[model samples]
Target: MIEPDSSGDRPSGSAPETTGRFIVVFAETEADPPAFLRSAAGLSNVADSRDFGHGPVDPATAGDADATVFASLGVAVVTADPQQAGALRMSSDQSNIESISPELVHHALSQGTLSPPSALFQDTEHFTWGLQATGAATSPRTGKGIRLAVLDTGFDSSHSDFAGRQVTVESFIPGEDPQDGHGHGTHCIGTSCGPRSSREGPGYGVASEADIYAGKVLSNSGSGSDGGIIAGIEWALVNGCAVISMSLGADIAQVHPPYTAIGRRVLDQGSLIIAAAGNNADRRQNDFGFVGAPANSPFILAVGALDEQLDLAYFSARTLPVRGGQVDIAGPGYRVHSSWLMPDRYNTISGTSMATPHVAGIAALWAEATGYRGRELWSVLVQESSRLQAPSVDVGSGLAMAPQE
Candidate 1:
């Protein structure tokens, strides 16, 4: 029942081009990735190859018979010869090549219409309502000793609130540093891994003591390619991050093969990838659209947005269950406040993008409290969430909550 978008028009503000000339070729579980590549080189031109963990293979000796077999996550990003690429796809170990597809683009899911702080009652930090609603405020566990990765634009390393925090950062965006120029990443990080409190406001963060691994997959302009995102995922897995939160996505109706594969692989490796369900819905207009790519994949946890009243946010996307993009959970997103780049260190924004980190931060707490990882951790989150009146199509298991312990 999952149908592809017939309208060729790309989502608004999305990058027009796909991930450049390179193509991603995934090796099947039983096949040896490096061995398969070496054998294929005899029939087709294999330029450069990169295996997870071992890094990039030398182009000159890529075809060496003794090449180490890529056993874990067995994926490779290769530059194929234009003439034989087609034949290679056809002849490549049909059993081993799980999928051959063009790398697509991904974007930060933040919507416009930034609201002023005064929109919510000023006496209390209404932005932190998400924390209170999820029981993160009272959770005895602080997500200590856990590594949580937020893959997005980047983090504002200069933010005073995180001055002494254990934050490790890496940038996948070409020619860009990890410093957050776009506020979206900073905001998401603020919610997931920020401290107890800041000078600008009360604590709006969830897993305050969790170690933060900010992976900048999107650039300052708030856009990036699938290659960058895949690389970021690999990095997170290599570093043993227990939870990977992605607040960025593209409005594609169909599931992307790469993300599906990556999501499964990450889960198998004991890491959970959480993504926004996107902010493309407008119930007032009666346009409840499908969840976006990456998130649409059944393996990734897709989250929807709610408002201060715990009602579904007007813009929160609902899953087309027939299409496999069901909302897995919900969190406060409308006019939510969080840290921004310095000088103006705080701002309020809305989107499923904002809601995703709330689940992530709470996931960290659950992980720390229950010692659960990967799919087990995912199950605990859904089982422990506060069920709301909303349909599963709109809010899945309902609002994600922090562990009571």
Candidate 2:
């Protein structure tokens, strides 16, 4: 669901008729508990009731059967203009019922993250990376010279685990890095560029020795859109990141312009932009019937997801990814462990969100080894990636083999 401003207006212009957003609505009877109504009704403040596209089921059937209800409603749903869409819009007769974006939702990501023990992943086996694909029993490159920028909600710089790691952080959204309040950014950073030292806690991160920048584009709830993402990319470039890892996705545009321009600049300036293929593989990333936008751009290394045991993941998108000569890669997404915000708990998060960082880390290691920059590192990355044996249009360059092996 999308949120409207306080006047119940959209962020910019009127919500486009093809606004590409949706909300669920339903009504409750007196017999139903008021608490449930509070939760469901709360959606009104952010999204506004008039914009709710479908449904008016009983509170009893609405809570657990929302999906079934939506399916029954079918494709004949009606969305509203943001200006007219504020809060609940009940009729005087109690015949009409609707829901809107929850007032408390504040952001997009549905769940808060759990924290990984800095000590638990102290060894290779329990860690996120033990060196990839280079054929060593362990990884050799520490990623000391690499600079990785994480574009997500925000980061928790105050954690002892991140003591000296943060260089700079800018919020495209209205928030602060110290407010890694959402936890997505924290986990993302831990994936690509967390420190390698044992004293830094045991959340096994990939480029343990690389410097980092936090580019907060998404809100604490993981909420974001194409605009913020583009802004984050520009910010990352200005900050001088060697690798900008985006563990997020956006709706693909039917039209294209300048998407390649920013990234090409990053690439030309010797930086790599690694992005998620998108979790919407099931929903369809766009009208082209495949991967999300920006990922479609030529300069990025788009990554798909895989399960921890190296199997193709359920969430990974299927696409014949090729931009110029660049063939994207895949990596572990599900059951792949990493740090969360809640202390002592490791998050088994999945999605291209989790997978993109693995590629960023490998590229960092490669940059460390070859002193390669710009398209040079990007070329090595594509060439060195594990090629698919029975590669499908869905699975790209097979899986990203453990970079250091």
Candidate 3:
């Protein structure tokens, strides 16, 4: 069920407007989107609109027989003249046209200091201490049949480690290929769905055998608009991905309506969306920043970062329930090592970004082990987590753990 935005009028503290002049309009689940969109006086076709499996509805017949065509989908991205953006918002009834939010920019959550790979232990087959802490090392489940989607900068498809693996790549960022030019996506993917072994060392992946859906939402510059990320989410859902991992976000105090809707929709569809809790905290100085947008939506699982000693990372944001953002769990993030784009092959980075994929990969393992999906899967993750001494606001239920065989 779509919850009403409790803040009444759209808050100014929500996601910043995108540089691009466009607004995403979401229709009611029972409304005829084509007809409704066509009725909007200023609505225009966005260049290169692809049919995302709803069988393209004709604008002419949208009000008639095809009125209900987009009823089930409940979402649409439309472009309007910049001068008419406000009028478009005013026209929405907050029902059939549920929301009209400006597409906002999202960035990779890897803004922390890079550390030497040696900072992480190398004794295990997987260089990441996260994999071991989450029990992925000994868990019987390999996430063989599960499909996990990672929406980020993209992946290093040419990497030898993932050669011959089942990877489906797509780029929502215009003029960019689904390849990891910025290296952030590759490292995140390496942690969540990478292989079991590589020439560099033991495989640092979690759901090693899981099918990978690498969606390039962010660009080479490591930033993306909310439109691209939403498109990627739609693609992942349409493709039947069991878990969608987002290691990217924007720091917004108010919960974005689109994400709240999307998160609820995904949960209803039996898939889980996990996102980073943001890396804005400086605990040493008593600065525990708030979680970011998307993750700020209560429906999405927000993950925080923990160090090797199980202490909250200095940069891991804490949950502020009053602000509607809360951490759901924690994962090893400090000085974590994982796959990087070739030539470099591997890198050690730290952030809530790194911790998110650990939960995602572990979620895949739990899904494979228990056959749980959606909200049930989410509960399993929380219920089965290894409790830590940390506060719930900082580390959620506890450290996210892999399901035991």
Q: State the lDDT at 177 in candidate 3.
A: 91
The per-prediction CA RMSD against the true structure, in angstroms, equals 24.5, 24.9, 24.6
TM-score of 2: 0.61
Rank ordering of all candidates by lDDT, starting from the highest: 3, 1, 2
User: By lDDT, is 1 or 2 better?
Assistant: 1
lDDT of 2 by residue, 1-405 (tens): 233432232454644323323343444432332223344333222321223345454444333322222333321122334333433333212533434442222346668565432322113543443223222115677678777888887777665566666457778885444356687887777777765444433445777778878888888877877677788887777776788898876656321346577668888888888888776655333422346666767777778775544555566665634452122777657655566675643455677888887778777888888888778987887677665432445446655543453
Per-candidate Cα lDDT values, in order, are 0.80, 0.60, 0.80
Query: Once superposed on the true structure, which residue ranges of model 3 sit more than 4 Å away at CA?
Result: 1-127
Clash number for each model: 0, 27, 0
Q: Write the per-residue lDDT of candidate 3 for residues 48-83, one digit (tens) a residue.
A: 123334466655543222122233446554444544
TM-score, model 1 to reference:
0.69
TM-score versus the correct structure, for each prediction:
0.69, 0.61, 0.69
Model 2 residue 189 CA deviation in Å: 0.7
**What is the C-alpha local distance difference test score of candidate 1?**
0.80
Q: lDDT for model 2, on a 0 to 1 scale? A: 0.60
